[model samples]
Target: MTETETAAQSSIWTDEPFDVHAEDPFDRGSFVATVVRRIQVATADDPSTVFGLVGPWGSGKTSILDRVRSGLGDGWQIADFTPWSSGDAASMSLEFVNTVADLLGEKAAGEHRAKLAGYAGFIAPLLGAIPIVGSGAQGTAEHLLDAIGSRPPWHKQFADLSQAIQTLGKRVLIVVDDVDRLGGSELLTLLRVVRLLGRFRGVHYLIAYDQDTVEDLLRSTGSVGRSAAFMEKIVQYPFETPPLPRAAVIRLLNGVLEELLAKTDSHLDHLGLQRATSLVDALAPQLRTPRALGRFREHLNAFADHVSTARLDLLDYVAITWLRLNAHGVWSQLDSWRHELRSGERATSLTETEKLTADIWEGRIAEAHPQADRTGTLDVLSFLFEGVDVRERRTFIKHPRAMNDPTYFERYLLLAIPEDDVDDELIRIVAAELDPDKFREAATALARVLDGNDDALANLAISRLTVFRENYTTPNLLLLQFLAERMHVRVDEAERVGSPRNGLRPLVAREMALAVLAGETSAPDIIEMFGETEALNAVWMAPRFAEFRDRRSDLAEGFARFWADRLRSEPGAYIKGGRLGGVAELVTFALEPEETNGLLDPAVTDYDSYIDLAEGFVYAAEWVGSSYTYELQFRKDAFRSLISASTLERYRPQVLEHSGKVEYDVEGHPSRDIPPEIVKAFTVDSLSAL
Candidate 1:
C-alpha cells in the first residue's frame, strides 16, 4: 500500500490501554480452546484438580486467568495471589490457606461458614481498623478461632471439620496462580499451604510457576523440596503450559498496538492481520518462550507510547526496538572510538573530519527479535544536520553554528519539503523536527567516533567510512573521528619535506614515492594531510583488510614518516633489532623532488641504495630481501605502480605471471604477468633511472 493509503487504515495496534484480554471471534478460539480443553479433561469425570495453568512473568498469564475466568463463567474458581510488589512467598501463604477456606468453606453443609463468617466479620473490621486480624492470619487467627469455633481450642474445631470433610469424599479444587510473582519466604509458605492442603485427600490445588523466573521463595525458606513434594502428589505431573495459541497471542498483541494505529485511521486487513499476528507468534518462542511476552511487549508500548497518528502494525513494535538499538549501537561504537584517541587529537584536527558514516540498520541486524523492527524507526540515524569543511588543514564539523543556531528549527521547515525528498535539504529539514541540542550533540558525537578508539578503531572506521562516502559523499557528521584518529596520522609541518637526511633518502624517497603514486590531488602541503579519498573509500567498502590494506601501504608510510618527525621532539619509539639497540632515531629523512608542485617533487642524483641489513618490518610482518636487505617492500611497490610497465620491465621485470609461472612476455603489464616470488624483488635499474 502507498504510505498515505496505508496510513489511512489506522490500525489499533498502536493505541494505549490495550485491552489485555479481549477475546475476538477470529483469534480467541485457538488460545481459549487449549485452555478449555485442559480444564475439561481434568474436571470432566468429577471435579479434578483445578487446571494448573503455569507460565513465566509477562507471558500474559494474568490475562489467561482473566480470559479463562470470563470464558468459563462460574465453572472454575480462581483465587489469585496479590503478593506486594516487594512481598515474599512466605507472606502469601496465609492468603493461600484463607482463600482455599473461603472458596470451599461456604459450600460446607452446617454452621461452619456462619461461625467462620462471624469470626471473619469481627476480625476483618478489627484488622481493617488494625492490621493482621484475618480469620486465619497469625496474630488474630488464634484469638478469633477460639471465639468463633466455640471450642476450648480452635485447632480441634478445624481438624474435626477437616476430618468430617475427608470422610464425606467431597472433592474440592482451588487454583492459586501468580505464585511466581512472590519471592523469598512468602513463595515457600504459599507452596507450604498447598502441601498442607494435601493432608485432605479430596482437596486439590493447582498452582502456576513462571518457567523463566528464578524463585527466591524456594531458596529463602529452604522448603523447595516440600513444594516439590506437593507438586509430585497433590499436583499432577509434568504440568506443561504450552504457549498461548498463535491466534490468541496475535489478538492480544494487536490489542497492545491499538491506540497508536487508531489515530491514523488504519484497519488491518487479513494479510496485515496475519502478518501482525505471526510477528508475535513466531518471535514469542525465540526470545525466551511466551512467558516473557508481556515484558517484551511492555518495552514496545513504552517506546511507541508517544507515537501518534502512526501506522501501528505488528512490525511497528519491532521497528521502535530496532531503531533504538541501532541508534544506541552507533553511539556506542562512536563512544568507544572517541575514548581511544591520542591526547593532541582532541584539541583540533578531528579524527575523520569527513562526512558521517554511522550505520543505521533498517532491520534486525542481530539475534531474532521481531519487536526490534516494530516501529519502522530503524533508519532514524541516517538523517543529517548542518556541516561544512573549513580550512583544508583543519576540518570543523558542527551543527550549523548560527547566532541562535537556525538549524534548531529545521524540522518544521521540512513540512514544506516534498515527502520524496532524500537529499541534504530534506535531511536538514527533518533534523529540525528533533530537539536542536539532541541533533547537534548526536552529530558532533558521531564525528568524534572516527578518532575514537585510537589508531585501531581509526583504521576500521576509515575503512567503513570510505565505503559509505563512495555511496554518498553527503553523509552527515557521524563516525568521522573514528576513521580520522586511527587511520590518518597527522604529520607536524615542522618536519622537513626537503632533500636527503644523512645519506639515507629511504624516508623521503618512500614519502615521495607514495605522493607520486597517489595522483596530484594527494600532494600534502606543509600542512595537514588525510588519506587519499580513493584509498579511504576503498578501506570503508572492502570486506577484507587485504583489499584495503593493499592500497594503504603507501599511505601508512606517509603517516609513519609524519610521526617519525614528531618523535624527533622526544624521539621516543621503542628501539628493536639495530646497531643503535632500539635507540630513538631523531633524524628526519629527505629527498630532492624531480618535479615541483606535483604528487612528489623528485630531483636528480638522489639515488639511495636499499640498506642491505638483517631485516625491516612492514605492518605486522618482516620482509627478507636479497643480500640481507632491510628495505621495506612498499617503496618499490609504489614507484613501480606509478612508472609505466615498460620503464623498469627488465630489473623490475615480469619475472612471473599472474598464473604463478614465469612471464617470458615482457610486453605484458609489468606487474600483471609476474609470479609471486618474482614480484617481491625491487630493481636498481634506471628508467630515466626513475
Candidate 2:
C-alpha cells in the first residue's frame, strides 16, 4: 500500500482544531456563536474594551477562538498577534505593531493606509530598535517624519495617532492568542502593548489564554502585585471556554477505536466486548479531552504494528498498551517479573521473602496509579498475567498468542523471536505437511535447511512436532520414518558432551513417532511402512513399537517375521556398526536359540566385532545433574539374552586382555569407549551357565 493508503487506514488523530461548525463533535458550535455575539456587542458599545477568552490548557480554547473568528460578519478589522513566536521584549512588541498595521492596510484606502503606517512608525521605534521590521520600514519611518515636519514628543505623537484612528470607519480588534506561553518579560511587554501603547479610540483587544497560567506568568515577573488583580485591570470581560462533556469524549474515542479495529477486521465476542468496555471505562478519567484520545491512538497504533494482532486477545492487548503508555513504572515492573507472573500452576509454596517481595510490588503499582481503583487495576493485571492472585467466575481460556502465555511473554516484549527459540512458522509447516503422499518430499526439503547456529533445522522442526503432536491427525508414518532416520545421522560426541543444546534430535523424533503411532489403529499399515523403511530406521523404532505390541497381536506376529527376514538378509551390517544393540529384542523374538547362535557365532569371531556387538548393549548415560553423572552403562540382560554361552566363552580371553578398568568421567575424557562393565557382563556374569 502507498503511504496515503496506510494513513487512511490508521485511526491516529492529528490533534488539529475543527475548521467549521459542522465539524464540531463536542457540541461547541453554539458556544462559539455565543462568544462571537458577545465580542461583537462589547466591541460595538465600548471602542477599546478588552475581552478575555479563558480556559485550562488543551481544553479546546484554540478551537473555540478559531470558530468565533470564522463566525463573525465582515467589515471589521481583525489582527491575530501570536506573542509566543517572539523570543524577547523588543521583537515581541515590534512584531505585534507590524502585524496590526499590515492587516489593517490590506483593505484600507490609500490615504487611510498611509495614516495607519504613520501611526506604526511613530510607536514602533520607541518600543524597540529602529530599522528592525524590514528594509522598507526605514523609508516609511523617514517619510512619516517628514510629513509630521519633525520628530514630535512621545505624548504628542500618541495624541496625533489617536485622532487619526477615529477617522477610520471600522472598529479594529487585536486578537492576541496563547499569551500564557510567553516568558516573564515577553508577557509583560505584550500586556504593555495592549493596555498602553496600542490602546486607541477605535481599537479593541480580544485575548485567549489559560487564566491560571497567565496569573502564574504575571507573578513570575516579580513586579506585579496580586496577579489576578493585575489581570482584571487589563481584561475587562473574562469568560472561560465551555466545559467538554465526558460523554462527548467517550463517543470520539469509540469512533476512533471502531475505525482501527475495522481495518483489522476484528469483532469482539460478547465476553470480549464486555472486558474491553470495562478496561476502557476504567481509563475514563484519563480520556477527558480530544488531545488525550489522540495520544492514546498514537500509542496503540505503534503497538499493533509489532505483535500478531489477529491471534491476540484484543481486550488484553488494549489493557497492556494502556499500562505501557500511562503507568510506565508498573510496565517496567511487569517486564522484570514476567517469568513469575506468567508461570503455570505452582509446584511449591512461596517463601516468606518471596511473599514480601510480591507485597512490595503491589504497593509500588498502587503508588504509580494512585487515581485508579485498586481492584480494577489488579483485575486487569490478573487477566493479563494469569498467575497473579485473582479469581475468575469462569474458567480461563488459554490463548498462546496472548501476553499471559509464558512461551509468548518475551515475544510480546522483545517484539521479535529470540535466537534459540523456534519460530511458529516451522510448526505451521510441519502441521501442513502431514499428508502421506507429500510427507517425504516436504520433510526432505525441510531437513536440508540450517538454522543460525548451523545445525540442521530439522532438529528444531521435530522438536516442535513433539510439542504439538496432538494437533496433528492420525499417524503419518512416512514423515515419522523420515525424521527417525535423519535424526540418527552421527553427531560429534565431543561437541555434544557438555552442551545441552546438541545431539537430542533422534530422541525427540522417536518420541514424536511413538505419539503418532498411539493414534493409529491399523496394525498392518504400520507393519508395511516399517518393512519398507531402511534397516537402521526400522531397528531404531522397533523397541518403541514393541512397547504397545501386547495390545496389538497383529503387530506382534508381523514384526517378528519382518525382523527375521532383515537379519537373514544382512546381519553383518548391524554387527559392524554397533546398530545390532537396538535390534536385540527383535533377534530374541524372531529366532530360536540355535538359529540366533548360527547367525551371530561367526559374526563376533574377532575382537573388533565383539566390541561392536557389545557397544550395541551400551548406552551413553542420561546427561543429568552434572557432567560427572554422564557415562556409559551396559544392559547386561539384553546382551546375555542374545549372545550364546559358547560365543561368550570364545570371546572371554580377548575381552579380559583388551578392556581394562573403565574410566567413567565424562568431563575429563569426552570420548566414549566400551566400558569394563560390558566385558564383565560378557565373560564373567554367570552367562556360561545360561
Candidate 3:
C-alpha cells in the first residue's frame, strides 16, 4: 500500500509521535511555546545552559523535544542526539562531540572550519580516554590536563573557536533524548560530558529522560543522598510532561472507534452506537496518557477484526477488551466462569483466595490508572456476569435492554474463545432462520457429526431453539429430541435454570404437546420419533389440553387411557422415576380424579409403597399448586383419599412418630393448602382413633 493508503487504514490512536511541524492534535502547542520562551530567557545571560525534560516512559518526552526543536527561530542551530543508539559510554560521548563538530563545520566558512576541525580532533582522543579515569588508570584526568597545558596552546585554540562562534551570534542547541534507556555507566558518562566536558560558550544542552530511573541509577553508583544535588548542578531547568486532559483522550479514542466502525461493513444500530459511546466514556478515566489510550485502541481494533463486529453487542465487546487490556487476570477468571455458567453451574460466592485475588487485581488497576474511573470498569464486569462481586460495591448495568438480550453474553463467549477454534457454522446457524424441515436436517446432521463433544455447538443449538420457538410454524420432533438429549447431559451434571436441559426442554416439550393436541401430530408418532421419556415430557407439559378437548377429544381420551395403563402396570413407578411433577400435570388431561385415587389406594394397603406414595403426594401437592385449579383439586383429592379415616388411623401414629409436623409450604407450592381433613388425619386426634 502507498503511504497515504496505509495511513488511511491505520488506527487514529497510533502510538507514533506527531511530527513537530504538523498540526498539534493534542493542543500541546502552547505548552511547547512556554518551554521555548523559558529556554531563550535562561540562555540569554549564560552562554551555556542545560534543561531537563522529565517524565515517565511513554509520557511524550521525545515529542516535547521535537516541539522545542520546531519552535526555535533561525538565530538558533539545533542538533538532536540519542545516546541509546551509541554502543557504550565512551562511544556516546565521542558521537556527541562529533555531531557538534559536524554542525559547527556546516555553519562555519573556510578558515573557521579548519579551526573547528582542530578542536574536534583534540577532543576526540581525550573523550576516548575519559573511560579510563574511573577505572583507576594512573594519571588519567591529571595527565589529560597536563597534556592540554603543553600542546599548541590548546586552551587558546578552544577559546578562539568559542569566540568565532560567538561572533556569529548564533546559539547552538544540542538535544539529547532517551538518556534513561542507557545503562548506569552510559547514563553517568553522558551526564559527565554534558556537565563537565561539553560546557562551551554559545552552546545549550536540552536532555530528556525519566527522572526517577536516572536518579536511581545515580544512587546505585554510590551517589546515595547526593544524586539530587548532582542532577541540580547538571540540569538548570526541569519540567515534567503534563497529563493529557481526559476530554482529549476521549476524543482521540472516539475518533479511532468511528474510523474502525466506518471502515467495516458492520451494522451498528442506535443501541450499538450508544453502547460504544458509553464504553469510551466509562474507560476514559483509566486511559490517562496518549500511549495508554493507544494500547487500548490497538487491543480493541484487533478484537473487532477477530470477532467481526457485524450485529455484535458493542458493550460486551468493549468490556472484554478492557479486561484484556487492564485486568488480564480478571479476564482469564471470567473465561473460566463462562464455561462454568454454560455448564449449568450456579454462581456461588467467591472463595477467600478468589476474593483476595480479585481485590488485589482491582487495587493494581486503580493504582496504575488513577485518572480512570475504575468503578465504571467494574460495573461493566458485573453486567456481563450476574454475580461478580467487586468488593462491597454492587454494580448493575444501566442499559436494561442490552442486559436482557442473549446476544450480549453470546458475543462475550465468541470473544473469550480462541479465534482459531470458534465454530463459525454454529454461529451462523444460530443467527439465521431455518424452516422446520431445514432445522431438523441441520440439527440431526450436527448431532451425528459432533457426537456431543462440542459444547459451543450445543450452546448455539439451544439458543437457536429459542429463536425457532417463536418463528417456526411447525414443530420438529427430531430437532427437539436432539436438543433434549444434549441438554440432558448438562442437566445431569447440575440442574440450573440456565441449563438447556431444565430450561429449554420444557418449552420444547410444550410445543410438541400443542402439535399433538391440535392434531398436527400424534402421541404414537411422537413416541416413535422421541423415546418414552420425551413422550411423558410432552404429556406432562400439556396440562392445558382441556382447553382443546372440544376439538380434539379423541387425542385427550387416548392420552388418558395410555397413562392409566402405565399407572396400573407400574403402581408407584412414575413417582419413583422422578416424574412426580409430570404426574401432577397429567391429572388435568390423562388421569381422572377417581383413576388417580385408585392408583394411590394400593399405596395405603402396602407399607413400602405408602412411604413412596406419601413422598410423591408431598411433591405433587407442591407441583400442582402452580397449575390450573382442576389439576390442583385432583391432586388434593388423591392425597385426601390416601389419608382416609381408616388409612390415617393405621399410619397417622407412624407418620406423626416419623415426622414432627406436616408442613406443605415450599418454593414450587407457594399457595398449596393441605386439606383440613388430611391435616386432621395426621394430627393428635388421629392417634386416639388408632
lDDT values of the candidates?
0.35, 0.58, 0.58
Root-mean-square deviation of every model: 19.5, 8.3, 10.6
Q: Any runs in candidate 2 off by more than 4 Å, and if so which?
A: 1-15, 26-43, 47-59, 73-77, 86-94, 98-173, 198-205, 210-216, 226-229, 232-284, 295-398, 401-423, 433-470, 474-561, 564-678, 682-690
**Model 1 error, position 430 (Å):** 12
**Which runs of model 1 end up more than 4 angstroms from their true locations?**
1-21, 24-35, 38-51, 73-110, 113-173, 197-203, 212-216, 224-230, 244-334, 337-690
What local lDDT score does residue 24 receive in model 2, on the 0 to 100 scale? 73
**Cα deviation of 644 in candidate 3 (Å)?**
24
Number of the top candidate by TM-score? 2
**213: Cα error in model 1, Å:** 3.3
lDDT of 1 by residue, 1-690 (tens): 223223322342322222435433223346656765566444322423534665655455554555555555554444544443323222333344455456554565344554433333333333323222223434543344335533323345445546544544444445556667565444544444454322343445545666444334554545444544444554463345455565544544555456435633445666555545544544433343343344445555554532321212334335334333433443333223222211112223654443322221223222233334322222221111122111111111121211112322221222222222112322232223235545555344433533333433333333333333334322222222222332343322222332111111121222223333444323333114333332323322222333234654444444334433433332212112221111111111122222111211111112221111101111112234442222223233333322334433432332222122333322222222234233323222212234
TM-score of each: 0.37, 0.64, 0.62
Ranking by TM-score: 2, 3, 1
Whole-model lDDT for model 2 versus the true structure? 0.58
lDDT of 3 by residue, 309-363 (tens): 3334455666677766776655555544554322223435574223333354356
Which is superior by lDDT, 1 or 3?
3
Candidate 2 deviation (Cα RMSD): 8.3
